[model samples]
Target: MGNLMEPSSASVYDGNLASDRVVIHVTSHQRIDQQILVKWRTKTFIARIVEDQEEWIPQFLTQAANFCGENVSRGSPKGSLGSGTTLRFWIDTWLEDKPFYLLFPDLFKLESYKGCLVKDRCTGGGEFSQWEWSWIRPPSTPMEIQQLLTMLTKIQNVTLSNQDDSWRWNADSSSCFTVKSMRIRLQNASYGPTHWVFPWNKFAPHKVNVLGWRIKMNRIATADQLAKRNISTTLSLCPICKAQNETAEHLFLLCPFVDYLWSFILSWCRVSTQKPCNLKDLMEVHQKANLNHWTQKLFQHVILSYIWVIWKTRNDSIFLTKNPSLRRAIKDLKGTSFFWLATRSNIPDLNWEKWRTFSF
Candidate 1:
């Protein structure tokens, strides 16, 4: 199909495709594609529920991602009670790992107040973080007392500081909230990736994966992209070859140097496939090779290593006055790929000598 905003009489965007691009690039910073997060409802939704605005209500709530209270309350509170008038013992997610109610369902059912505040159950009466929790709720029977004792035993090691209860997003290491992370967690909770988990299945480092992602999105700072942005640099010459215009296609493929590298890699893996013409083509060539999962993963690692090492060498040439050579790059690629594959994958039991040689 033509571009979505092509000058069509029946186009919904009124033939203004640039506006669509602008909205996609600028507004949706956290989103991968133009998609909504799967979180059913947030604490902010409680106040917004009373707002009479028609657009305020999300379409996904009733259509696709229905109201799921348990799904929405994934983050657990780490800090102890300060002035926990806002934190509910059962409703809000206050427990460090899972919700307290989920941990002790019997207590949750028999509790007097479902929305009991953390401050209401603390021992000391200070807004400081040093306050201790001492709940001796009157139990009805011996079984209930045992349940209470069990709950207390579980909580004895848990030290409650005077800090205010705050939710931590468990998806990321930073414990910060982002729509992308929330969506990834929710999506993976019930559904995982339809394909391999990682690109090339543990071929390169985190930075290389990031570079591959940017290359796929056409966001890498190629000479053409720079010229388009009015930056003064080579308009047609490649930084590496200084022959043709540098593009994702030419930089990674079609170049005589890359052709040599691919020749070595393909012969090494014993995969008799044509060299891919572009980044996307290179990424998909392994699938078409019809090898088993392990062999395909092996080829992917090599291809990913090639891309990363080439890019790094190209950068070294440009910035460090280091002359780029195919032999040096291939050597670096071998060492780097071995470091990644050996540590990350831990399979095939291939040594450095075997990996260096064409021992496929």
Candidate 2:
């Protein structure tokens, strides 16, 4: 072995020389140390020293640049964009700059303003919409909301519509009339006790439902139940005649009493048609008939009056009250029909003498 601490000198060596072998090993170790120093320096450089620096700084700079560009484009004042007086900016810088006044000249006109404000003050503007407009301000005290609503409703009756033309209602008219009328009737303060036969609370669109409830209250099984004894869907025995089966067709339309009344009315109206057997078939025929508005209204009112009189007469007989004569029933129907027609503003100029001449 060569002296371990002695510097190895460059010299040509035999292939098996030990000193040559030692020199080669020393050179290899030095090269490894130099590589390690280079690696350490590369890792310690400031660019790579901080964790996440390379990843986060570029993103932050890019966002900052974009924000600055946006601020410059909008001509924003020299402060944080989010820290400005938002309401002031909106009113002054945005709204004031628009030409809205020029485009909507009538919008600020006194007449238009009066109309808009009048609607707000009037009744029938629902509570929610009224509240939104601040027309009817929020109540400050407990139960004030209810009190205000009540007062508003009461005032509605006197100021709801044009008194001279009470029947007229345009689309823009206040809904006060309808609402107040309904509320008073529902409270039963306006109409008398004699008018309270129909249960207004339970009344709905379905005629059968109304009649069914009435039937239930009387504790009488419908004709359908009687028919079930013989496995039939139809009840065959006229409630009025007792000579004919009480099918809906016979009871409402084809019975002799009803047929005679209907025939008289049709002849008076100067219209002719085959008689219908049921309510549905009657309605279908009426739909096909080409009648003018006044005639149609007269016919409808007549039909309603007839039905009402018949039902009332039936109830009277069942309750053992004074039984209705055919003549009396017809008289009541005609009077009621005429009263309803006269109330409508657009009643036709019929031959009043001819109608009055017809004996009930």
Candidate 3:
């Protein structure tokens, strides 16, 4: 019937007791006076209650206290407080009071805070503060933002260029090209974020086959070898001379057979005989040559095609049901190079018969 306080003892009352200690038997009204009753309790009693529910009390009190404090603080001296302002200000204040701002000297340095503000326009603070907390600082103009993005993208591209894995196996030079341009023609295609609309689904079978061969060549003999003998174990015999070492250098340039092929190709192209001992060195010679742009690329492609064809012929002899004759091999190399050029580029007419006249 009533509430009563007893110091250092539990207050016991009969059903008819008349005091401020009103006990409501109904569960629905238990929370009605809980706040007032809690405030009236002695410090010892409050501590005991806190101890009993310490696990959840802190969070509960924090939220409730924030809601009440904001409602009270935002009340105008001459006007009633609005529901929206009370709710908004409460949440804003609570967020501003979060431990991050209290502990850290620079809130912008924390990735979590930056990410949060970037994702949501809300900070436990004002709108201006929220904007300031974003990971990307506001640019002076749209152009400035674009410039910053461009600079960052350029840096990323440079980083990728410098990475070892980015290099492709450029057979002509036995090195890599920093960039490659691929011509794309679109048919019944849609645009992507970066590239134009092209029917990639309908890729040319020949091109796919060529690409596969390139990838395979790039992966071949990646491991380091101490001697030419180690190379011979992998490649049966010297691809050039069919004698001596079968290492990459011997197979490509040093071997007598390859030396003969190089001489023949160079003479046919009307290029000087400046022989190099290995593919790497041969490429350097080609690079330094006073050849026109198209001519240089054409020559490089021709050399690459020759190497690829030679390797294919070797594989055919070893695994396939046929052996390649010198005359047939030369013909195959010339034909393959011609077909590649015809399909991939427009070039001066090549005289294959004249090219093949050079002997091994």
Candidate 4:
């Protein structure tokens, strides 16, 4: 092998090549470029005043001015509206979502104005003209009529509230355009729930592996989480001891039940620490245990099993109305984790006796 310790003369820009690979990705997002954003902002000036007058804009900005219309056409508008003057009924992503054509192809073909504004479809903007259900053509068949009526029922309740139409980035919950969310969507078109980031450890049990994924995502349906989602629950407090609000972190780490469990488990492995405050801390405890990567991974599975078993015990106590001792849960974890490591680790001769008395 070549001299491993020798410092070669590779430039610092070597790593930058990875970032350069994404240039095509960034350039594809025309909405983000400041020049393009500015160009689109002055679309009205181009449309009304500078119509057919390329010289009106400086010669240098000709291409930018031209690109604005195309970019604006690409972006779909979202939100509830007032005088639907600015909203496009069909081409723009307004009512019924994913553009009217994609949702109801039949109605899209019959519409007179391909680029008709939302106001054109609505009845009145005269002084204080209230919005009512109105469409131009009567349906040809009973099926078409039923379709129209069904589509109407969705929007009939949509009475205008005197608010101007506003655009929103529908990709995220905040409804604001964010770079990370945009990049993630660009990376995944058919994006659904964020994929759970479970560990790459092959030796971890299925239950523990899935539990780690859920915990990392903070998606465990603790009582506090249920309350946040407006779920009807009699109490938000810990169902076990009724001490504090039951969150994943509290239940998995700091609760009186887990406190004793962790004390014994950590002490068994000679890893000492206070209660972990979050999922991250719990996961990282193995890394900080002064162990090598191999041992750390083994410990990670054990820790995951610890959390998973505790969660299961908590759920059983609540739903099945059963009483569980910490000792029982700890015993369950030891058995499960040992079994998993033995079968999945592919170690030469891993056994329960060795696992139970494992140190360093």
Candidate with maximal lDDT: 4
- Give per-candidate clash totals: 1, 6, 5, 0
Tens digit per residue, CA lDDT, model 2, 271-338: 66677654544534444456765455445455555656666665565456554577887787777656
Across 1-360, the per-residue lDDT of candidate 1 in tens digits comes to: 012222222211122222221111213333323233322233233335432332222222222222323343453223234456555555554454455666667667677776676666654455223323333465667766777687676645444455655434444466533334434444444322233233535556778777776676567888888888888874456767888888878888877888888888877778888777667777778887868887787777787888899889878878797888988987898888888887886567678888777465
lDDT of 4 by residue, 92-187 (tens): 556654566556666666666677766776664434433433345756877666666766766664544467665554544655433344344444
Model 3 has a clash total of 5
C-alpha local distance difference test of each model: 0.58, 0.39, 0.39, 0.60
How would the candidate models be sorted by TM-score, starting from the highest?
4, 1, 3, 2
Which pairs clash inside model 2?
Answer: 236-245, 236-246, 237-245, 237-246, 238-245, 238-246
TM-score of 4: 0.52
Worst 10 residues of 1 by lDDT: 17-26
TM-score of each: 0.48, 0.33, 0.35, 0.52
Off by over 4 Å in 4: 1-117, 120-197
Position 185, candidate 1: lDDT = 45
How much does candidate 1 score in TM-score? 0.48
